[model samples]
Target: MLIQALTPADKSPLLALARRIADAGCNLSESRVSTIGTEVSLMLLASGAWDALAKLETALTKLARDESLRLVHYRTGQRGNSAQLPYLVEVVAADRPGIVARIVEFFAQHEISVEQLNSTRYRAMQTGAEMFQAQFTIGIPADIHIAALRDDFLELCDGMNLDAIMDPVKF
Candidate 1:
């Protein structure tokens, strides 16, 4: 099952949530936690027997009501193996609106699937200049011409004055 929770940043219920999952005989398989602005967000995947999962659902419900957390959960299946190659794309540029949208659109046009993306905007400590940085983990179809794709991606970044790099993910 996949669970998501959102609460005020100052009130972290990570330990409580983990404890409940364990008490319900569930194994946490994956999790992502982040603080965005004033809210803390959590995404967790847990696996267990059907009865245990039902127990977890009940526990989570009570916890949500007691803690006033925004929570959602649903059952999900495992991901199948893919034939695409994993690549990482990184970009750093002057802070501007639409940068992420433009990059995502570029990949979408080529039928590339973005597995994960993390981006941030901050001021440079040295120069106080606003900057934007983004990292994308994408799956590129094996049949795609890498050389031509790289050239095209670089060309797009160059046009926007964004420094970028595209490289295969190494284990």
Candidate 2:
């Protein structure tokens, strides 16, 4: 099952949620928790027998009501094995709009799948200049020509005055 919760940022809520999942006889398979602005967002994947899952659902409902959380949950299946190779793409450049959109478009045009992406803008400490950085985990089809793809990607980045690298993930 997949569970997502959003609540006012607090240190205790995560532990409380985890405890409830455990107490309900569910095993947490994966989780992502982040503090965005003043809210804490949680995404969790839990696995167990049907009864345990049902118990977890009940527990989650009670917890949400008690703690005033915005919650969403649903049953989900696991990802199928893929024949694509994993690669990491990193970009760094002066902060500007549409950079992420352009990068995503490039990968989409090549039929590559972006499995994960994280991007942030911040002021550089040294010069107090605004900077943008992004990291993408992409799945490249086995039949794609790696060198050609890298070349095209670099060309695009160069055109935008961005520093970028695309390399195979190591383990």
Candidate 3:
């Protein structure tokens, strides 16, 4: 199941929310929380039986209403478990729009899928140049030629004047 919650950027509400999920017998398989400005956003994946899910639904509803938190919850069905190789790709370049889109399109053209991506843009402390950086966790099909892929990726990065690296993701 997938659960998303938005609450005040305080500690108590989140603790209460976690307790509520636990009391309903749901196990949090994966979760991520981030603060955007003054609000805290949470995305969680909980696993359990239907009855426990029902209890969790009730608890979440009450938590949202009583605590003034905004939330959404639903069953997410099955997950993707691929036999593909996992790799981490990192790119850094001068800040510019469409960098992410262009890189994603390049991956799509090669039939690769991105499982997770984190990107940020900031000014370099010393150089004062605006820079963009992205780290992507991608799944490469077992049949793909890793050497060829790396070469092609490097060539593309060279054309874009970006610094990048692609390597296996270690457990």
Best by lDDT: 1
- How far is 150's C-alpha from truth in model 3 (Å)? 1.5
TM for every model, in the order presented, reads 0.92, 0.91, 0.90
lDDT of 3 by residue, 1-171 (tens): 788888778743667767877999989888888786688888888888899989988888777775557788888887778779999999999999999998999999999999888888899999999999999999999999999999999899999999999999999
Pairs that collide, model 1: none
**Residue-level lDDT for 170 in candidate 1:** 96
RMSD of 2: 1.6
Error of 1 at 58 (Å): 1.1
Which candidate number maximizes TM-score? Answer: 1
Task: Arrange candidates, best lDDT first.
Answer: 1, 2, 3
| Residue range 1-171, candidate 1, lDDT tens digits | 999999998887899889999999999999999999899999999999999999999999888885558998888998778789999999999999999999999999999999989999999999999999999999999999999999999999999999999999999
RMSD of 3: 1.9
* Candidate 2 Cα lDDT to native: 0.91
List model 2 lDDT by residue over 79-165, tens digit each: 889799999999999999999999999999999999888888899999999999999999999999999999999999999999999
lDDT of each: 0.94, 0.91, 0.88
Worst 10 residues of 1 by lDDT: 60-69
